[model samples]
Target: MTNEKVDVVIVGAGASGSVYASVLAKAGKKVVLLESGPDWQLTDLISSEIWGRRVKPAGAPILLEGKNPMAYAAQGGWGVGGAALHYYANFPRLLPTDFRMKSEHGRGHDWPIAYEDVAPFYDKVAREIGVSGDARAEEKWRPAGEAYPMPPMKTFRNGNIWLKAFEASGIPMVPAPVGMNSVEFKGRPACLYDGWCHVGCPIGALANPQVTYLGEARKAGAEVRAWSTVTRVLTNPAGTRVTGVEYYDDKHQKQTQEASVVLLAAWSAQNPRLLLNSATDKHPKGLGNASGLVGHFMMSHHVASTWAMFDEDVQNHMGTIAVQYMSYERYPKKSHDGAFGSSFVTAGFAVKTTDLANSRADLYGPELADYMKRAARNLAGIKTFGEEQPNVENRVELASEKDEFGMPLGRLIHSFDSDAVALWNANFEEGLNVARASGAKEAWSARGTMPTSHLLGGTIMGTSAANSVVNSYGQSHELPNLWVAGPGIFPTEGASNPTFTIFALSQRGAERMASQWGTLTN
Candidate 1:
């Protein structure tokens, strides 16, 4: 087996890991980033959904089970940029109440840290990432923070129609906080508004990891080794400190890279999967699984769609995808009324004829073409996002089967609580009302689908080792030298998208690591 060493060895080159690598390397630390996928360049990205599929995780097969199986392929990525390459960049911060869910609403579990603890990092990350938004427009309920780096993106006809409907319905809608550049900043060009975000941003207008922190990390002397699939985190005999990580290199050969500190910023699934698979006699469950909670508390957002056919052509495909506008009329804990969790609605996108045809299933050649023509000119869609409460029963487990690499595969099982279901129903109805209020001849609700990208919990952070795998700083309670970054440390799923919070926490975690480096290594 090949052997190498570094001061810090990071697994995954996604949004969180890239940020940590950038920070640590800039601090003059010897850093090595191991990514399971191939290294991607900005030029490699294209504006085709089919091509975008190639970027998703292909390291191993994962078994998904539950009423709503995790949309693994759509939610994960394999290249150096990780899943952020295909993200829509809807960057909304977590509400203050989101952190104290259990204490404030007596519903979900509480986070070990509070919103104030992470707000500065939020500001720092937003400025670094070049967010475009109007804090004042986000309404009086928005948590305090610096104004967005750039003004909000110009709203198109779709947003105008959506705003009118929201006003008619007495729902508050605001310019979406997006990570795409409204005006050129940091040498990256302004967005073309080509409306291909789901397919990945071909240009550098969007702040995907490849164009942002990965480049910063490289400039700071961090080395990124792509096509390295880490199978386990090795530890010392006492199992109280991380020794290194074991992985399969590009040639499918076994390799070991020793490090003083090991950071796992792989997404929620793989982070816990690697941790659980690293079990040893000293730590019988897993490296950081002393509480037997390595792969528990899985959470995902509930999403439903409402579509309407307007008399006028809306050109819904003209602007950014999933980054136009958002309505937070129902996003606060105190405003829930009878609904159990926070929820919000965002403007949706134009549809392809084939997709609409598939949805219509019964139509033939002529009828399908006719409906497609009408939908192409007149259709408008909106999607609702609702928070999920953490449940122990919703988890990721090791499957009986093994992958081609001979590692135990991940099995995801999740089910929404009754309250979550109620919240989704309420949001779905509201979506219909918003559409109808927009003066649609017809409006209908589509069954809610779970977003694979926003998955949280599993290896959650908490107050102590008795009930948590990591502390608030993402430090393992069992292994001091091991740290977990990203949404995996989240205690509960907040209603807003998790990308901004992930960046903020990663920044905080990186600073914490840099501050403790001398003492920990010595």
Candidate 2:
């Protein structure tokens, strides 16, 4: 085995890891970012949907199928850019009430930090990442912050239809702020409105990691090693601090890297998995499981959606990946039932030819061609993505089976709570009503098994070590030098895409780590 040393070691070069690396490197820290996936760039993203399916990690086969069925339908980008490469650039902030869930509605745990505490960080992140929207329109519930960097993307025909329905229903339909560029900013070109963002943005108009933080971090002298699968965090005989990580390189050879501090920035599932796998005589349950809560409190956004076929050509397919909509009215506090409110967006962009085929197949294949022919005439679909209360039962644990690498794989155990189900039902009924109001021949509600891109809550944070795995600053209570930077540190899953919050927390953690680097020792 080969060994090397660095000031800081970060695992997983996804959204949070990339941001952490950028901030630390800019602060003049020597950093090494290890990614299990290969390094990929915008130029590597092919424009075709078929090519997109072939874009999984070089050697990590899709682990969601067969005997080791995934606990949830998890989908994320694999590579140095991580899942941000395939993320739809919806950059909405969690409402103020989302922070104090337990105090406000008597549900789930509250965040250790409030909206006010994180608001400045949010504003800074938004400006740095270049969000585009009218902040004034979202002022009702969105936490106070600086205005968006650019004007909202132009409303397409389908967006206009949703706006009309929203107005008629007394539900606000303000522009949804997005990460897609509306105008040239920070040297990146404006969005082409091509509707292929879910696959990946090849033109750098969207703020994926490759086009934003990772690209900047590389230029700032951070070293990113892809295809480096970390197996365990090595520590001194005392087990009081992390010394380095033992990993399997691309060639399946073992190696170790020494570091003064270690940051676990992997996604929700993998973050807890790694911690659980790092057990020793001192931490038999897990590295930081003194409270026995390393992989508990798993949460995912509850999703509900409805599609309508309209007589008018609503341009069913065209425009940016995300088109338009509103979410302020759905703030959790407004419902008064202690249930989280629902957020809706109009999927007005053109459905790719492949999506059209798949949607037809999903509805039954006999009328497939006819459905495609009438797709343009139908125009719009409303999708509601909401927050779920954190339930300890819904968790990530290790199964008896092992992965191809002979390491125990993650077993996800999750289910929606009564509150989540109530919100989902209400949103579904509301969406159907809106579709009917929009002059639809038929309105169909879809509630497929709730899968989400916004993964949150596992190695949660709290004011005290007894209540959470990590402290407010993301430093583990049991292991001082081992920190976490990702959505996995969230105590609550607010109804917003997690990228912005992830960036903010990572910046905060990196700042804290950089200032206290001298105190942390291997």
Candidate 3:
């Protein structure tokens, strides 16, 4: 056991974990962030898509057994910067109505707080991270928040091709908000516009955790130890507070780190898995499983691409691959009765052979050769992001199998409900219509719906302790000193990339924890 104690110990040096470390450490707390992957840094981020796969998490494999199994290996982060190291940095905020779904639509669970409550944090993170976009262009669907810090990213010829389709179809399109810099800000360089971002950005232009909070945390004197896998959350005899955690160091030796406060930001699935695996005599279900909802409500969005083949070269390989144009203004809520979620349409995607969305892995021989030849210079792509409703049946449980550390493996089970399928169908049709209207010589979509890496729910936050593991601030209802950070606390995730929201919530929770340290620790 390590006798030295700290004020805060955070598990997972990923996006939200690094945010808390940065904020609380800056506020003078003794903080330590434990990461289970390699000690990666900015220089380690190579420009090759194959090399970028190094950043994806690979500590322990969870037994995925769902009709819609999430692609965790591709979406999760393994090292210092975490998943942000290779992300496109699509930084759109959640819609306002997303917070009050049950109240307005009588579908999905309502968030404990509203969009207004998180708006300030959104602005704070945006300014700090230097987001780029035109707020007025997104005014129709954008929630109330301060304007982006930088000008929108440069649009390409592919955007022009998609813009006509949106216009002709009477759908609205706006410049997509992105975390990559449009201009030099806060000492970071500007983007190179090489469209090679699918792998990772070696330059500091993209606001990955290495260039953002994780960097700030290092400057603020927060200690981060890589290959430190936390296995259990140690608690007091009364099970009312957490003392710290037990983890395996790089040597695979069991060690203990003592702290007054412990926070778990180890992704959506692992957060609940850690809680459940920590089951003890005092709490057999788990540290935060008294409510029996810690592992329930696991959800992931369905992302489908609609690619168009143009007669003339649209320069699809030109600019940012995340998306050049965005559309959300044409979503008809009344038209789709069974579908009950937001639809986020993004245009301008470059074909990356590593990505399943672009590669037809099932095709071979002449068909494969022909498809590759046509896709080389003629393909322009758009994607439809449909939010999945929270279902209790989709959950994470402790599998009978154990890892090298003797800890039970996490069993992830998820399936698309009727409503989710409806939402996907509706969103897919909407995307196909826009593509056909664009005067493309050919238009086609991915063979089937693809599960997004954007995982949510599982150990959700709510007003009551009976149904939720944490509160709006990510404070545990069962153990005050043990909180679950990250997207796992989300009651409902809107059809938007969650990295920005993760940063905002981490900022909010960390700021509050710093301000109310005396009360929180007591």
Q: Per-model C-alpha lDDT, please?
A: 0.83, 0.76, 0.83
User: Who wins the TM-score comparison?
Assistant: 3
Tens digits of per-residue lDDT, candidate 3, 1-522, equal 584899999998888998999999899999999888888866776777777777777878989887888878877778777777778789888877888878987877889998988889989998998999988788777565578999998887777788877887777788899988999989998887887776677788888888889889989999998999999999888877889999999999999999999999988999888999888889999988889998999888887677788888777667876787887763434445667677787887555555423446567788877877776777787887878888999999999999999999999998988777788787778778888998888877675545665889998999988878899999998788887888898998878888889899999999988888997688
Please give, for residues 479-509, the per-residue lDDT of candidate 2 as tens digits.
Answer: 8899997888998877777777888888777
Q: What is the alpha-carbon RMSD of candidate 3 to the true structure?
A: 1.6
Which 10-residue window of candidate 2 scores lowest in summed lDDT?
65-74
Clashing pairs in 2: 77-83, 193-319, 310-378, 317-350, 318-350
In the range 1-522, model 1's lDDT, one tens digit per residue, is 856678999999999999999999999999999998889877777767677677877867778888767776866778798888878788888878888998987876788899899989988988897999887788476666789899988777756777788888777778889889999989998988767776678678889987888889999999999988899999988776889999989998989999999999888988988988888999888878879888899998888667777888787667777558887778875454567888867884545444455435556889988978787767777877898888898888788788767789988887887777788888878888888888889788766364444788898999988888899889999788899999999998778888989999999999999998876786
TM-score of each: 0.96, 0.94, 0.97
Misplaced by over 4 Å in model 3 are 330-338, 355-362
